[model samples]
Target: MGFRNFRFQIVVRVLLLVATVFVFFKIGFNATLVSTQIFVGLLISGQTVALIVFMERTTNRLIKFLNTIKYDDFTEVFTSRGEGEKFDELYKSYNEVIKKFKDIRSEKEATTHYFQAVVQHIGIGILTFKKSGEVQLMNNAAKCLLQVPRLEQIEHLRAVSPQLVEQLLTLPAGQSAVLKLPHGKERVPVSLYAVDLVLRGEDFRLVSIQNIQRELEDKEMEAWQNLIRVLTHEIMNSVTPIASLAGSVAADVQDYLEAQPGTQICLEREETEDMGLALQTIEKRSQGLVRFVNDFRSLARVPTPKKQLFSVEEMLKQLQLLFQEEVAHENILFIVNCRPASLTVLADRELLEQVLINLVRNAIHALADQPNKTLQLEAFQDEDSRTVLQVSDNGTGISEEAQEQIFLPFYTTKPTGSGIGLSLSKQIMRLHKGSLSVSSELSKGTTFTLRF
Candidate 1:
C-alpha cells in the first residue's frame, strides 16, 4: 500500500507538470497574456523541482540507512519528519533492523565473556597456541604451575624446562606425558594433555597442564597400602596358627619331659636334646615371621592424624636429642636448623615425629660408611608456602634403581631392612594430607623431603 501511494503521488505530480507545460506552450504565442504565461511557467517549474526532490528524498534516506548498517552504527535511529506514511513505515523498519543487530552483538559479547571466564578460572591449566609456537591463550592455573607471569611463545618455557617445551611441541593429540619440571627448590610432576584445534582455517593446539605430583603420590601410596593390606592379612592368618601350634608343641614336649622320670619313651638323652633344640628353633622362626607380618600390617593401619599446631624448631630439637648418643657413637655430626626458629606446622605431632624418626634413621644409615658423616634436619616453608622438613645426609647416597622402589612395601636396600618403615611413614603423611619424597644421587648425598 505504501508503494502504491508513492507511485500515485509521483504520477499526479508528473501529470500536473505536463499539463502546466502544455498550457504554457499554448499561451506562449499570445502577446497580451505574457504575465499569465510567466506565472504558469513558474508553477510548472515549482512542480518539477518538488517531484525530483520528493523522489530523491526517499533514495537518500535508503542510502543513509544502508550506510548505517554497513558501518555497524546501530546507534542511528531513523525517524519520520512529516515525510508521509510511506517514510514513517520505512523509518520504523530501519530502526527495528538496527535494534536486532544491536541485540545480536550484545549477545555475542556476553557469550564470549562467559566462555573466557570459564577458561580462565578452571582448576586445570589450559593453553592454546598456534602451530608456529605462538601462545594465544594461557590461563591462571597454567601460569601458576609453570611459575611464569606470562608466556608469549612456547619456546620461552625452555628456560623453565627444555623438556617441557619439547613435550608441548611434539606431543601428539589424544596422548599425554608426565613431565617432571623443577619449580623453585622442588620438582613438580605435571601431566600435559594435548588436542589439535583448527579455528578460522588456522591450526592450533590446546594443551592442559595439571600438577599431578600429589595425585601420583596418593595413587602410589594407595596401591602399596592395598597390596600390604592384602599380604599382611593373608600372612597373619596363615602365620598366626603356625606360631601358636609351634609354641603349643614346644610346651607340651617340655611338660612331658619334666613330668616323666625315666619313663622309657624311645629316646636317648642326645636324641631328646636334639628334639628340644629343633622345637625351639621352629618356635623362634614362627614368632619372627609373626613379628614381620605385624610390622607390615602397620602400613595398612595408619591412624588418622590427631593434628595440632606445634613449633618445628622444638620438633627438630627432640629428634636431635633422641639420636644424640647414636650420632656421637658413630662419630657423626648431627645438625638441626629451622629458619626463623618459630616456624610451626599443623599436624599430628606424634605421627609426624614418627615419620621424622624413620627418615632420620635412614639418613643416619646412609651416612654410616662415609668418612665425614653429616646428618642435617632442616625445616622451612616452601615456595607454595607449605611446611617442609628435610632430612639430609652426606653419606653414600642411594642408587637410582633403589630410589624408585624405596617407597614400595618390602623393598629395602639394607641387608637387615624390613622395608616397612618408609612405606608406613609415607602412609602416615598421606593420612595427614601431606607427602613424603626422596631425592638422592649416588656417592653424593640423600635428602628426604616431607611436604605439608
Candidate 2:
C-alpha cells in the first residue's frame, strides 16, 4: 500500500528510524562498522523527507477545499485517488456537504424567481427604494402607472406627478395617502401604502400603489342613486296629496259658483267648514314637507372635523355624567370598562362626543320597554393592536338587512328618526383615519366599535 494508506505509511517510517537507531548502537559497540552506519543514516533522512512531503500535500488539499467553499465553487470535484485512506474519507464527506449546499442554493434561487414573477404580475404597482431615493426594484405595473419604461430613482415619478414624489419620499411607514395625478387632460386618484424593511443591513421602503378613481366613482354614484330614491319618495308623498286636494277644491268651488249663478257665491255652513279644514290640513302638510327638506339640507352640510388629542377614559366619564339621570330614570344598568386608563386618541373630541351621545341615546330608546336593560362602554386594544372604543347594549338588536343600510344617509328605523346620525358618525371616523363598525344579534344585543 506504500504511503497511500496513512497507517501503513506511519509504520514504515517508524521501522526505518528504529533501524537507524540500531545501526548507531552497533557502531558504538564495534570499531569498523562506519559504512553500514552511514547507509542507515541515509535511509533515516530519506524517510523523514517523505513524511514531510506527505504532510505538505495534506495541507495543500485542505487549503484547496477551504478556497472552494469560500468562493462557492461547487463545480470543483474532490477526488480520493492516490491520497491516504484518511484523506479519502475526508474528501468524500466534503463532496457530500458541497452537494447539499449546492442543492440548497438552487432551491433558494428557484423560490426567489417565483416570488419575482408574482411581484411583477400583480395588478397593484410595487416599488422598493433606498432612503436616498435610489430605486432597487420596479415592477411592470409601476412602469405602466408611471408611463415610464424604467425607473432608477424616485424623482423620476415627478413626470407623472410631483406631488406623488413628495408623498412617496416623506410619508411615514405604515401610513397611506391619496394623491391626484394628472393623466392626459384628467386626473386619476392614486392610493399609496408604504412599509419599511431592512435588507442586508440597509434600510428600504416598499410601497404599493393603486388607482382608486374607479372605486370612488362607483361608490359616489351608488350614494347618489340612494339619495335620489329617498328624495323622490318624500316628494311624491307630499306632491301627490297636494295635487289631488287642489283639484278637488277647484271643482267644489266651481260647482258652488254655478249653483249661485253670480260672482258673490254663498256656501252652506258644512261646506264652508269642510273647505276650512282642507286648507288647514294642506298647510300642515306643506310645513312638514318644508321641515323634511331642511333636515336633508342639514345632513348635507356637516362641517369638517377639527381634531385634537384627548384621553378616552375622561371622555367616558363625562358621557356617564351627562346620561346619569336618563339611565337612572330608565332603571338601566350602566357599566364603563377601560383598560390602561391613560389611553389617548387623536380625533375631534367634540364630534366624537356627539357620535357617542347619539349611540347611547339610541341604546336607551331601544331598551325603553325591555327588562334587564344593560349598557356597556369599553376601551381596549383589539387583536390587531388597534385602540378600540366600544358601546354595547343588551336590548333589541338590528336585523341583518337593516344593518347593511344603517350607514346610508337618511336611513332610520326609529319612528321619529332623521337617519343622519350613523352616517355622520361614519364620516367623522373616516376623517380621523379610523373606522366605525357594528355587530349585533337579533333579540340579544348590539355592539358598536370604533377603531383607531
Candidate 3:
C-alpha cells in the first residue's frame, strides 16, 4: 500500500512538471511574457527536485529498518512522520516486530541464567570444553573437585592429574570410566561420564566427574567382610574338629605304647617308629591349618581407629630403628626423611605403625635380589595440607598384573606370603579415614603411600 501511494505521487509530480514545461516553451519566444515563462520553468525544476527527495526518503527509511533487524537492534523505534496513512501503518508494523524481538531476547537471557545457576550449584563436577582443548565452562563444583581456582584450558588439569586430563580428552561420548586421582595426599576415585555436544555448530565435550571414593570403599569393605565371614565359618567348623581329633589321637597313641609292654603286645621297631612319626606329622599339619584360619579371621575383625596426633618424624625414626638390623644384614641402603621435622598426623598410632611396618617389610623382601638395594621412608605434607607417608624400594618391582590384586585378601605373588598384609593394611587406613595406595613399574620398584 505504501509503495502504491508513493508511485502515484511520483506520477502526479511528473505530469504537473511536464505541463509546466510545455507552458514555459509555448511562451518562450514571446518577449512580452518572458518573466512569466521564467517563473514557470523555475516551478518545473522545484517539482522535479521534490519528487526525487520524496522517493529517496521512503527508500532510505526502508533500508534503515532492515538494517536494524539484521543487527538485532530492537531499540530502533520507527515513528510516524505524518506522511500518509500508508506510512503510519508501516511504522506501526515495524514497532510491533521490534517489540517481539525484544521479548524473545529477554526470554533467552532468562533461560541462560537459570541454566547457569543449576550448573554452578550442582554437586557433580561439570566441565565443558571445545575440540581444541579450550575450556568453555567449568562449574564451581568442578573447580573445587580439581582444587583449581580457574581453568582456561584442559591442559592445566595435567598438574592435578595427568591421567585425568588424558581421560577427559579421549573419553568417548556415552561411555563412563572410574579412575583414581591423587588429590592432595589422598587418592580419590572419581567416576567420569562424557557426552558429545554441539553448540552453534561448534563441537564440544561435556564431562561429569563425581568423587566415588567413599562408595568404592564401602563396597570393597562389604565384599571383604562377607567373604571373610563365610570362609572363617566354614573353615573353623571343619578344621576345629580335625585339629582336636589329631591331638586326641596323638595322646591315645602315647598311652597305648606305654601300656603295650604290660599287655604282651610286640611290634617291629621300624613299624613303631613309622607310626609315631606319622602321628606327629598329623598333629603339626592340623595346628598349622588352625593358625592359618585364625589369620584370615583378623581381616574381618579390624578395630575402629583410636585417633591421636603423633609426630611423623618420631614415627619414621622408630620404624627405621626397628628395621636397622635387617637392612644391615641385607646390605641395603635405608633412607629416612621427614620434612619440617614437626609434621604430625591424627590417627591410631599403633594401627598406623602396623601399616608402615607391613609396607617396609614388603619393600625389604623386594630388595632381596637387587645388586644395589635402596629402601626409603618419606614423611611430609602434601600440597593440600594432608600428611603422607611413603615407603619405596629400588629393587625388583611388582608386575602390572600383581599390582591390580595386591590389596586383595589371599592374593599374593610370594610363594610363602600369607597374602593378608596389604589387604589388612588397607583396612586399617580406611578405619583412620585415610587411604593406602601403591605405584610400581617393572624393574623400577614400588612405593606404598599411606595418606591421612
Global lDDT of each candidate: 0.87, 0.87, 0.87
Worst 10 residues of 1 by lDDT: 1-10
Clashing pairs in 1: none
Mind giving the per-residue lDDT tens digits that candidate 3 earns over 132-159?
A: 9999899998888899999999998898
Compose the digit string of candidate 1's lDDT tens values, residues 231-291: 7755675577767767676786787778776765455688678767767777776776777
- Checking candidate 2 for backbone clashes, the offending pairs are none
Query: Which portions of model 3 miss their true places by more than 4 Å?
Result: 1-266
RMSD of each: 16.9, 4.2, 13.5
TM-score of each: 0.50, 0.81, 0.52
